[model samples]
Target chain A: MGDTFRDEELLADVICRLIGDVRHVAVGAQSPIPATAALLAQARGGGSPYVSLLGSRAHTFFTDGARELFDCAGQGRVDVFFLSGGQIDSEGNINLVSVGDYAHPKARFPGSFGSAYLYYVVPKVILFRTEHSRRTLVPKVDFVSAPGGSPGNVYRSGGPIGLVTNRCLFDFDRARRRFRLASVHPGHGVAEVIDNTGFDFDRPTHVPVTPAPSAETLALLRTTVAPMLAEVYPEFVKRVFNVPAPSP
Target chain B: MPLIAQSLDEALAPIAGGRLLAVPRESSGVAMAATRALIRRGIKRLHLVTLPTSSLQADLLIGAGCIETLETSAVSLGEFGPAPRFVAAILSGAIKMRDATCPALHAQLQAAEKGVPFMPLRGLLGSDVLAHRPDWKTIDNPFGNNDPIVLLPALTPDVALFHAPMADRAGNVFIGTQRELVVMAHAAQRTIVTVEKIHDGDLLRDPRLAAGTLAGFYVEAIAVSPRGAWPLPLPDHYGIDAAHMAEYARLAATPEGFAQYLDRYVYEKRAA
Candidate 1:
């Protein structure tokens, strides 16, 4: 486990564990990490589900779960959706629209493809970020691109159930409706999670390790997802996950 | 040959066979009303552009006839299977699939909008799609012996129906960019424009707003409807009606249920 817990590895570990042992999970397009994780889990024979999303149709995965996004509310099949944040409010509201104004936006972030509907509708939503700091963790989202926390809690008015950063895994408390430090990736600690947050949280004494993929999972991830990414996003895959042999 | 302006019965007068008519996804207000009016007049064929989120406005479109066709890409279905009629079309080979993943299809549409005869694109090189879809073909570079470029012939429709924010008496209109209405305008032989309100000016207001986007010269008849693409989505107007769309999901899930819903909303109802 000493491959220097890279960002892609961290994402894969967090996503695989998040799904636990479900048979089906759907993601969106433009999400590279989650796409890899689902493929990795399925390929590794870890009792994990297939990762079906846009563009990953019949080509990437053994089975396609792309249809889950459209009927997320009506059919209710998808287990997770990956999202990002430009601005987030205290109530778990997110805004991917613009940092400044709606009409004449300053930084007009790509408007949510289906993030708004998916965030509110999907049963399980995950907010992921590479950097974990006060700047990234805002007091509130300027736009409600996707809900991190919705009223009535998930299942009724659903929002993000989990957040995974390079540092740790964060899960919102169902009753209190505030993000509580759930676990940290291996080699990381509670202090790291707390230091990165903008808001206060009831810090757990021992923030557990966001589990890593088993040896079998590692092999499958390398073989299945790596090959798929190499086939599809060849350049991005090499640049992001390029891990040279560890120096002495 | 009647020039029906802002009227459903007038626009769809030719195709009142209760078959579905293809329309863009983001139409609203008067455009939606006119579509509804056409449905009431017994034009059953309704083809909606399916996106990821539900095209809730399609509920109104459903009432038009029997929702005989639902044409869209894989991304549009979200979680469920393809719409029933669309599925039937695929199996029966009546409605040809333009596999959205194929860049050739987009280029073809783009070429049509640009008033071109054909368009060249990539990604269909190693695929078996072109061979199956007789409409598409891959030809050698007429210039040199380098490589082949896949081409999609321009697709010109019989009529293009669009909902705009405003239009004048002459049918010159302005549609905010949300719907990509310009593509619809160019790809059709005849264009039907529905306006929310008829402004006094030429409807462009200023050349700055015009931007060569909406070509009034392309439009055929101008219809006026207040809420054409209702409960669906608009450019700068409103978001989709999730609740209404959910009801449609319920209706669309089953064959009998969808037909019954159509009867209550479309068949028995009088023109608005």
Candidate 2:
């Protein structure tokens, strides 16, 4: 993987840019792309933003157990966090519970972990879903594990800043409670996104293609970030980066 | 003195049928040995409360028909894929599911530890999780103007169970950085533990060991079962058995396969 980058790498680069210059970034379990992005951000920022990868001994700073992550988020120490859903609506509502009815239904995803709370507390909660289609980006979510926007009376410090998918990138306007098409990824166009999307979104006359990862970023990811990621996500690194698993 | 049981069954005697049993997350020491014993004994109607989330442990119990109610943040097999049993149970309405976010579970347990009726949490203002949970309430912040926050009722389980690296004869358990065990012990009516080994010396007497030690006062019983958290990691002690987990995910996909798995791994007594 010399000059060219995989879709995962491109997604990671985009998420890393979304992470920006935060004080701390927390990546949850089963999120290899977001984890890669956080690590990349840390490498680029010279370790300014503390990266906490849950279930990794080396990456996390919290010694107070699983609860510490939530407590730290509550205190406003965590700046960036990632959340995904089985179904996401145009308004930014995410559903992680079930597909059809609450009592009885069709498909059922894993229950919400910390999205109900973390989506409200973490300053920049980036919504990410690898699958971008009518099935995932629905007109309305069956259940709101966490809402994209809350009323004024509710205490909310943070919410979805934007949503990134394999097809395109969309920026969420909190006040307007809608998503605007930012740009389509390489080899993808505005019509493809609109055709696949379940809900309507605003797009300019000319939507640019998402930028690919730079050579410097790809080099850093392959050399430095790949090794660090192997600690938590061995299989992902092995498959994506072609790095062999170390002998136990 | 710690009530050191001779066998895993006796160590789990207090966790009777229909009792509320609280367990820790996967990375934290999971009492897999004891869980198997419970299944072998045909334990039923247990209201299982995962401190925050769980994986294979919960899946096995649910598949075995041991759980009547499950209160947890989420249950997944991590990299292995979706927890097949858990998903099936929810879709079939096999058990009562009380969906909660991660922090809400922690706050409720903290409330019980402090002997409070309820604890105020920041989120869950508009989610369906709050709507489904009739017990949880939203209250205006008396301290602030027009501020509303969710209140979670204190959750005190009948017993808290887990596995640890070691425990002293005096019953003090060394949990290292897994401080959530301490919280579970504080909130539960009784705490039962299985250890890989029993240290000869008193755990609380040593300054180095004392900080990470859960005093015998909270631990009701202890049993020695090496590799008690097998298939799951014991943090510093061992890494997860990925191959075994993948096998389990494949085998536990259907009811017949799950029963077959139980017969092979759970019911049989294999040498460690």
Chain B vs. true chain B: TM-score for each candidate?
0.76, 0.98
RMSD in Å for all candidates: 20.4, 1.3
lDDT of 2 by residue, B206-242 (tens): 8988889999999999999999999888888888887
Candidate 1, B1-272: lDDT as tens digits: 21436465665554444332445543222255665566555555444433322233343444333455543323222222234433333344443333332123334445777888997643233322333346667677776465565677876656666676776655667664333456656666677776666767655657755653365687777756665555444445554454555566677656677777667655676545
- Colliding residue pairs in candidate 2: none
Worst 10 residues of 2 chain B by lDDT: B263-272
lDDT of 2 by residue, A1-248 (tens): 24888899999999999999889999987889999999999999988789999988889999898999999999999999999999999999999999999999799888899999999999999999999999999999999999999999888899999999999899999999999999899878888899999998888888888989999999999999999998777778998999976432
> What is the lDDT, from 0 to 100, of the residue A14 in candidate 1?
73
lDDT of 2: 0.92
Best by TM-score: 2
DockQ of each: 0.03, 0.79
Candidate 2 second chain TM: 0.98
